[model samples]
Target: MASTTLRLPGLGWALLSLLLAALFSSCCLASASPVMNGPPTTWLSAPVPAEDTAQLRVFLPSPEARDQFLWRLAGAGVSADLTTLGFCSSRCVDLLVPEVDRQAVEAALPADAVLRTAERNLGGRLRAERDRLAGDAHRTDFSGVTRASDFFEDFRTYAQIEAFMDSLLAAYPEALSGFVSGRTFEGRPIRSMVLSVGGNSTVVDAGRRSIHLQAGQHAREWLSPPTLLYILSGFLEETSGSANLPLRDLLSQFDIYITPVVNVDGYLHTWKGDRLWRKNRRVNSGSNFLGVDLNRNWGPNSTWCTEGSSTFPGSDVYCGTEAFSEPETQAMSQLLDSLPNVALAIDYHTYGPMILYPLQHTYDPAEGDDAAHFDHLATVMADAIRAVHGQEYEPMPGSQLYPHSGGLIDYAYYTRRIPAFTVELRGDGFIVPPSNILESGEENYRGLIDILPLL
Candidate 1:
């Protein structure tokens, strides 16, 4: 019999115990880290509601100050809930900044500053903002959709998106089948739908070519999801005797799946609190701030920060704590597992008009690899789409466009062996406006039509 003796001095045991405690605590921390240095700006003196410890309300002097301040805050780890912004020859913006940085933020501003953390009546200010928007100060309504767009179900909320989905399904019941993909960290329902002429009969019974298209992984990219929605609407429309006849014919050939919004909680936060909420709402401690970049949560290439992302959990480009840590991301991962035959997958994003293929998540070229076949297919699709719209969409590997890692499109192509691309929808490279919705939607519809025939 062999006997081994293990001994630990009192101090050694204490250190070991402490290390164990830390390991346990980190597990409880939210998955994902932000890139901000030090504590996030806090409003030390603002009177907050009992139920809301993290409420923020900024009242700036001139509308110009509001825009500048909001941009600065967003640039410096502070998120702004913008109420109004526009251009009347020039741009003006009205916003509310989080209370976390109230004192330091105020002290840095001009003494005659209009920016304020507290006013005589907080509730009344909210009421006035609500009423102003209710009257359509910025002309928020969409032409094709009749419903009034507002904060609760704002122009880009999950509810409005789902309503639009319902409309698409109604128009093509035989071709559409809806599924609850999963739920957000905040428990909002993440929904998805499939569009196909043969429907489940084709996809389930025999082998069928499939394409998965998803958009709005980043909440602030409002233009991303709309293009997908428009494309779905066009594909399923019964254009019995119109120019869309070819598009109608393509829908019959391939099964198309769509996810309008991946980060529902963050999108809702954008409508209710901040217009630039770009991550999923995952709570963390030691600080009242939290969220993760859903686009950076794919499992294949974890820890690929420092290229186009950050490790400090407070930064806008924060990659999650670990790959697939997000339920929404995991849901998409599962869907891919179930639909392994997907010939092509697209994760749409925005503010940059381009069609990019793998490897965004890695610098390794897809030039001579087996993925070369899919890469060639992507070139064909990109060229065909651009020809129809006359919109110059550069077709290149992600590394060529921008160096990034752990992105969905990269994972789909490199790991799952499926051809995938990430389409950065129209925004003229960031100057998005509500009026451009229909035009952008139509362009995306045309692009999708051109690609569908090739697929």
Candidate 2:
């Protein structure tokens, strides 16, 4: 038998090398555990009682302190629910620790730390609110409404949202357009809608100015998508009716693109399995960990594995293997890149009642008139939101909340040079009841209307 030898081209050898490197990297990442780098500190040695079940609010003086505490908690294998209100500020966090871990956590705190609230049944209160909302939803009557397009009484499922988008396109064939902007890791379509008064435009027209509104980047923020839908409905009504001349004029001048849900897989997961899932469902190659925080997966100024985000695969704010690693984020980046005339972009989040501007990775002001413009627009939007329900929303730099990296709004402003805002709607936390859905939509709609004039 002739000696069997395989001859390979230089490109083939290079490909083989890349494959080996990838395999090695994956193996290393799979076996590597996330380590806490800070100096070790003393912890409470007493065993926690089973009945000591209540959440506590521990306030740290600074972000550094808060981060240190988080690392400590992680190291101790203690679970914590970190709130965003005082994130990067001196009033640095509402840490919800399990009853068993409360003593240990409280003891681990620095002397200057303040206990804002004693252990309370916050979970029970939230559950009660949800139950009440569900009861109200059952009692709601849709007898007079003829079309599915008119349904907006409660929060909708992913299927319902998609169906609603379809109905909008069917109802307004001439003015509204829909497309699968991208797909999630689980192959779910990331749907988007465009509202151009007078005619339907499938492609982005460079000559026409536009504003992009996106929501539901995080799975648990169910209030966001409905708010976007409400805004879309308002635009549709304007296109059909003679009323709201100002809104009609605004619509005529600018095409509005709305992406109701960016993380479809995670959103569905919330409904089907876990209610608090916050990231996109992306399986890590080496580990069994699933999901990547899409907000922490953008580029240019992405401070990966730092401050607000984490290098650990299991973290809630995991930035992913690399910037724009998730297809959802990549699709969004592409969408923004394709639209040159996008003057304003808003990424809606929840529970903070905040209108945050760019530079989330740092406190440094943006170049030229960018900072001024962001501040003006943010203040205008916040004021408009406040006028609706007398609910005051803070309008400030995103860094004021936390030193976040790779956020969508930050990417839009810093890299794309488009003015952007991250609107955290409603103050009732992530689980806003169905009763507040309509009000949240209306309040956000009012704020959105104010945004157009500034744009």
Candidate 3:
């Protein structure tokens, strides 16, 4: 462990630069020893344990080079998670690499790609963050506590996020209500929060259109779950004049359903096991991998594992053994099916800082009305996001980014005819700073609502 990370070869000078630039880094990283000790147990070498994997920032020259880079990693028996791989710039991405495989992984990079350490000690960082979990927001004997004192200032556990939702339901019974949509594989409830005029979303009103928004589909995306929670908070605050947004009119015409955490088991695992886990905790039939990427578990049946999804259980982009195979994905799919007139659906994810639309399962852009509608609305939404803090969010068809099939947006658009979207939130990685919670939520919330009235 480097006593101080101050620019030595492979010393994570790049990551250290970010730590120095961030405001909270001074306090949290006062001692600044983000490293762990490991001893070889094999004769030659062994794969780095997943928990100890290091994050690498790789810059590829073009999108084609990105696919080739993934293939190179796959050839070297390495798995890359496409779902949350941060696309920080036009050609830059962040990936997790095992310490033992660093040399081989570097050898596997595209000829023109540039690689640098993003986070050299992932396990140490997660441990340090967990120690700070005492985080002042506890709801005791429960009178009125919506979130932790620093809810917007820190990323929280799934339990705390659930408690926050339940507290809001009790606090504003007339406007907010919820139900357990389904239980996860581990028997944890996948709760859905509803915001409507009368707090009843089980049945859609005669003239109302429904909107579904969810985050935490990929467990490692800690920023997403809280972003949705903050958005929900903004809506609640509006009723009391504490925050002002044009929600009353939107509520009049739409029944909004928000699910903060869908991958309950995997999310809990991140807190106690691996912080970079990107799947639902599913025990595969004969494989060592114990999870399935829920985002890649959606279905059109025929196109389930066709393109960007993987047939291999160990791959980060692995589409489940079968589409909608995981309990969490099934629960969400059914929830969307139940919405009588679902007008739009947004599956929130992280690190691209972009907005994406349908035609994801193939290499073709949406053809007609869907194309125009998606393009226009996505551009408008991206502009709305930039207005908040000048963070640019590119809007494009999902296939352009990557041909990910069985994605939630595709399921909603192709099968249900609902205008679906995916908002890849601000930041370069899953371990986004806690201070980003409020702004990420605010920009995305504003971008979303700004387009609602237009629809």
Candidate 4:
């Protein structure tokens, strides 16, 4: 824990880490190129009005195409966001390009790169998505959850989300205990609910292992909170009614900790300010940027701001001024340290049907995380998810998706020695349809419970 705290390394260690990285992390050289610091990874924040932006799903033919596109973007001075919390693949990524620059971005790409506009008007899509998710949020019988299908029919505001948790707490007092993890940058309480058959202390007294499921590190991924809430509702249900035997067994023996939203300020901002906001509400000193990307503000790892993140305050993937610079991440890391025994940690995200495991900052295999065991668990989880709705979820290392430094999963895995993972939910646009929330949660519930017996 001492070594893993949110403190920068001394010059000696920092240089040593680089040397060792140069020696063995060659596999991730392309991804780890500090691309974010320069104009290549920077999308220049787009030139057009923010609301006029459109999303492009670019299919790169090869690594060369990807590189050329980045350089082309830089040379053309065209803004093409290739990756971020944005969905990415071995040769494909989704980008948000300005309406005027679409043709320029398209021309910058190689002939082989297949670029398709995912959303014609990102702002209009979000506005409509908000309206749709706001449907029938008020119900006559909203006193308490009579059945597991009580809520999640629509997206909820921060207040509504908290109210939903309170309802669950009141309904299952014996099984649920609510606590404030900490305050966010905006002074909002970051809350969590622990689910155990008898209660939290009982789980501790029994020496039960805990698995934490959290979502909403990025603000605009609106489906994440409710999806996680869906999972929470499923697990906290009476075991007698659940045909999910593994979940029953899990509840009988393990503690389930659920945090529906980690970036409270960002989420609140999404509701009140920009519907597409991505970072926490932190006004950087001497800069116009008003937030720091919480996902990239984690850890003091060797890869801190090297790749997959930016030093610029305006960048979407900005890593903050330093590791754990934001209160949200500090709160999250505090929560991680408070857990007596964490068997696994999974941070959920939106717009991807993928299960990602750690050693995320590098392409190298983890020395002690038992790659085979991790693979097996991820494989089974993916299968279970697919079985539910005939939708596929690829299980792979996060680095293979894209090198992300200072990521929460990397911090949880490399520092705490916990088996950490990230699940990207439903690879649709961030403005996911409301109807899909319950179904995605159900499928993910299957994926999660399937691995409990094995854990």
TM-score of 2: 0.80
Per-candidate local distance difference test: 0.55, 0.66, 0.69, 0.69
Cα lDDT over the full model 4: 0.69
User: How much is the lDDT of residue 393 in candidate 3?
Assistant: 92
- Model 1: lDDT equals 0.55
- By summed lDDT, the worst window of 10 consecutive residues in model 1 runs over 38-47
Model 4 regions lying over 4 Å from their true place? 1-39, 44-52, 79-85, 133-143, 146-150, 198-203, 240-246
> What's the residue-level lDDT of 415 in candidate 4?
65
Q: Give the TM-scores of the predictions, in the order they appear.
A: 0.65, 0.80, 0.82, 0.85
Query: Considering TM-score, where higher is better, how would the candidates rank from best to worst?
Result: 4, 3, 2, 1
Of the pair 1 and 3, which is ahead by lDDT?
A: 3
Query: In terms of TM-score, how similar is model 3 to the real structure?
Result: 0.82
For each candidate, how many residue pairs have backbone atoms clashing (under 3 Å)?
A: 18, 0, 1, 2
Clashes of 2: 0
Model 3 clashing residue pairs (backbone) = 137-148
RMSD of each: 12.7, 10.6, 11.0, 7.8
**Residue 360, candidate 2: how far off, in angstroms?**
0.7
- Sort the predicted structures by lDDT, highest score first: 4, 3, 2, 1
